[model samples]
Target: MKAHKSKTLIVYSFLLLFCSCGLFIDKDCFDSNEYKFYLPFTLSPAQDTFHINDTIRLRADFSHELFDSITLKYYKVENEPLMCYFYFFRIDTTPTPHYTNQFSIEVDTGNVIISPDPETALRYIVYEYDKSRYVFSVKFIPHQRGVFLFGFGSEPQQHVNFQKKCPGELMDIYFTTNDGVDNNFYMMAQSPDSSMNAVPQHGFNRSGSYCFRVVE
Candidate 1:
C-alpha cells in the first residue's frame, strides 16, 4: 500500500508539471499574437517635397498574412486643413466584390481621426480575397514652413523620435522642398514613454511622430 501511494503521488506531480508547462506555452502564444496586432504599417508619400501652404498627399499602405481589420492614425505638426481618402482592392480572382466603409474626422489641433465610415456599415475585408491590400491617402495644407515631417501608423497617439533626440526605428516621413528639390529621407523613432532616457527602444518598436518645419 505504501508503494502504491507513492506511485500515485508521483503521477499527480507529473500531471501538475505538464499543466504548468502548457500554461506557459499558452502565455507565450498570446504575447506573440498581441505583438503582431500592434505591429505598425507602412506610410509613404507620393513625393518628398512640398511648398508651404501647399496641399500635400500621403499614401499609407499595409499587407498582412492573414486578413485582419486595421485602423490607421495620421498626425501632423502644424495645425492645417486635412483630408483623408481610403481605398480597398480585392486581389483575388472572383466575380463578387467586397467593399469597406471609410470615414474621416475634421482636422483639429494638427491631428485628424480616420476610420471605417459608419454610415455604410461595411467592414474592410482582408482574407476574403487573395493578397488583399488597403491604401489610404492623407491631404493637408501646411501652414507653417520649415523641415516638416508627417507619418501614419497603427498607434493613434502622436509620438515620433527625431534624429537628434531619440532615434530607433523609421517612424516618420520628412517633407522639405516644395518643388521636388532638396528632399531628405531618413528614419526617426520615439519611445512610447517620453519619461524614459534617450535610448533606442528594443526591437525598434515605439510610437510615430509627425515632425515638420514650416518656413515663411
Candidate 2:
C-alpha cells in the first residue's frame, strides 16, 4: 500500500514541475557590467515579536527589477493539523516541537500568482506566487506562541542536531537582467531555529536572518 502511494506521489511531482507555469527565467541574470546583487529588500517584520491573534506583516522591496519571475512557495501555517515530513505521519516518541513541524502563522499572498493551477496540486508547487515585481508582501496572524522561524539553511543547537530540514517557505528568483549573464537562479529564504549557521540564509551565508517570537 505504501509503495503504491509513493508511485502516485512521484507522478504528481513530475506533473507540477513540468506542467505548472513554465520554466523560471530572467533577462538580466549575470551582466558583466552589473557586478553586485543584493538581499533585494530587507524583510523587516512589523515588530521584533508578536502575540497570539496579532497580525504580522512581512514585506520586502526590490532595488531593481531583477526577477522577471519569482517562484514563491508557502505552507499552510495556521489551523493546520498535519506537520510532519514523512509521507505519512511518523509514529514515534520523538518530541517534535510545533515550531519544528510547521510555520506559526497563516499566510495570505493576495492574488500574487504566476503559475497555473495543476490538476493534482498535492504533487507540486505546494503554493506559488510571482506576480509582484516591486514588492513581496504578506499578512499573517500567529497561531502558536513561541520562537518560530521561516525559510531554509542551517543552524546548530545543543542536544539535538538539525540541518537541511524542510523549509517553512522558499522563494526562487529568476533574474531578468536582459543582459548577457551567467545562468543562475537566485534564492531567498529564512532560517529555522538553530545555533550554528551552516548554510546560506537570506541569500548569503548568514548575511542575515528573520527570527520572531510570539506570545499569548
Candidate 3:
C-alpha cells in the first residue's frame, strides 16, 4: 500500500509541473496573465558639489546605459532658488566637474538635493549641481565595501552592511567643495540618538575600496 501511495504522489507532482510550464510555453495563457506594475526608478547619486557664494557648476556625461528618458527634480529647504539646466551638446567625460550656464542657484545656506526618476530597467541618469560653498565636501555613494552607519549617535542608529542591503540603503549626505578642485567625498552616518552612551547609527557598509568618481 505504501508503494502505491508513493506512485500516486509522483503522478500528481508531474501533473503540477506540466501545468506550471504553461505559464511560459502557453503564449495565449501567458498573455492573459499580463499585468503592468510601477517600475521603480533606476538612478544613483552620481556626484555632489558644495561651495559658499562661489558659483557651483554641473555637467553630466552619460553612457548608452543611460539611454532612457529621465525626469529630474530639484528640491531645496527654503524659498531658495537653485538653478539648473540640461546640457545635451557638451557632456564632461572626465573626473572633473564642469559648470553649465543653463543652471544657477541663489541660496544663503542649505542643501539642494536632486533626484532623477528614470522609468525603466537598470538604465541610469546622472544629476549634477553646485553650491556656493559648504562646511565640507559632500560624500557621494561609497565605492568601497564595509558596513556603514547612518543617523549615528542620534536617537536611532541606522547602519548599512552592504552584504544585507545593497542599492536600497538610505543616505543622509550633503555636498561641499571648499577645500580645493579635488572633491573629497566623506562617509558619514547621522546621529540617531540625542543622548550619550547610546549606540551610534549609520547608513551602509562598503566591502571593497571605493573611489569617488563620476558615473558617466
**Candidate 1 residue 113 C-alpha distance from true site, Å:** 3.3
Give the residue spans of candidate 2 off by over 4 A.
Answer: 1-36, 42-46, 63-133, 152-208
Which candidate number has the best lDDT?
Answer: 1
Better of 1 and 2 by TM-score: 2
In the range 29-87, model 3's lDDT, one tens digit per residue, is 23222111111111123233322222333222222111111212121212112121111
Ranking of all predicted structures according to TM-score, beginning with the best and ending with the worst: 2, 1, 3
Model 2 lowest lDDT segment of ten: 82-91
Comparing 1 and 2 on lDDT, the stronger one: 1
Using lDDT as the measure, what is the rank order of every candidate, best first? 1, 2, 3
Runs in model 1 deviating more than 4 A are 1-49, 66-134, 151-216
Task: Report the alpha-carbon TM-score of model 3 versus the true structure.
Answer: 0.19
Q: How many Å off is the CA of 74 in candidate 1?
A: 26
Highest TM-score model number: 2
Give the alpha-carbon lDDT of every model: 0.33, 0.32, 0.25
Candidate 2 versus the native: TM-score? Answer: 0.34
